[model samples]
Target: MDGGVLEDEVNRARLVHAAGLVAPDDAQLAGALSASDDAIAEAGRQRRILAATLGNAVNVLNPSMIVLGGFLGSLRDVDRDAFDDEVRARALAASAENLELASAALGADRLLIGAADAAMQRLLADPLG
Candidate 1:
């Protein structure tokens, strides 16, 4: 539960299959490097994990849509479908109906961009706006 340990875990997860070092201070560049270096395979792995996990969830609750963000969106079609199939096979039959998965329309910075949008929305909704 130490802060350093938690941060290390985060970094390790981020860079588990990374081809190079990825540090917190260099996360932005690391994100880019990740996208350029192993985005496809990594994304496929993630998708497969998600699919299998969701498929195995008790009672089944497959997401109607899956939005691949971060470095994952850049993956090619073949990898995408493979991941989709992995998830579909595990997903509940009814839950898998009409399921859709696609890369984020925004690029690598979608998370940051989304945070900005959320902040702006929260501010605009505030009485001070």
Candidate 2:
């Protein structure tokens, strides 16, 4: 999954949450980031919610490998563990076989790196090679 969440502060103590899914072709994952305390808290809350949603989605997909990318892709172990647990909870037993969950290899630059890598790979695979 590729996306980003940004929180915004509407007032001194109030905040607004804005986030969305990002497509591979999207140039930027721009959004609002809250400075307010509540907004910050809301961002955290939304992060967890997103983690759970991702876990559930992965469970549903049950792919052999699951790669998490985006702003929060580099979350700490605890956060990653929480996401994994949620994914497992929602996934079926058979689907969990050899499941690999890890941070995105490209970190925050995955999209750019992936594009370059693809280009290089294609170039290498060309008949001209």
Candidate 3:
């Protein structure tokens, strides 16, 4: 509700009341992995979101493989099985069949590489401009 915005005091208060956190940092969120049921539920929510997004992508792009980069790629380190299961369940059989999901192999350099690649693509598409 309210677009999940935490801008207002009421929303932030509600989030704090519900999750017992006021803007948890990455380390805090990561620590939650083994600390509480809420974290598990949040992880599940993330998996579902990923599943839906990837499912749509599969239907549209029909990519044989998908590389999860950036923060998304880090899910492999958190709970690979759950992520895989969610994707398998949500994506169409034809779309998911033979689909491969791999974490970015570029490690910390992925963001830089991705940015450079995007820039190159844009340049190539308008070489004269």
**lDDT of candidate model 1 versus the reference:** 0.54
Q: Compared with the true structure, what per-residue lDDT tens digits does model 2 show for residues 1-129?
A: 236432321121222223233342212221323334543465456556655665566667768877755544433232567667656666676776567777666655776788999999989889597
Q: Which residue pairs come into collision in candidate 1? A: 51-87, 55-90
Give residue 62's error in model 1 in angstroms: 3.6
After superposition, candidate 1 runs with Cα above 4 Å error? 1-18, 21-48, 57-59, 71-78, 127-129
Local lDDT at 124 for model 1: 84
Number of backbone collisions per candidate, in order?
Answer: 2, 2, 0
Q: Itemize residue pairs with steric clashes in candidate 2.
A: 7-33, 7-34
TM-scores for every predicted model: 0.56, 0.52, 0.57
Candidate No. with top TM-score: 3
Mind giving the per-residue lDDT tens digits that candidate 3 earns over 1-129? 235422232222332234456666434544554456765555555555666667778878888998876446544447777677677667788888888888778866766898999999999999998
Best by lDDT: 3
Report lDDT per candidate.
Answer: 0.54, 0.52, 0.62
Q: After superposition, how far is residue 98 of candidate 2 from its true place, in Å?
A: 3.8
How would the candidate models be sorted by lDDT, starting from the highest?
Answer: 3, 1, 2
**Candidate 3 worst ten-residue window by lDDT:** 6-15
For the record, the alpha-carbon RMSD of candidate 1 to the native fold, in angstroms, is 6.4
**Alpha-carbon lDDT of model 2:** 0.52
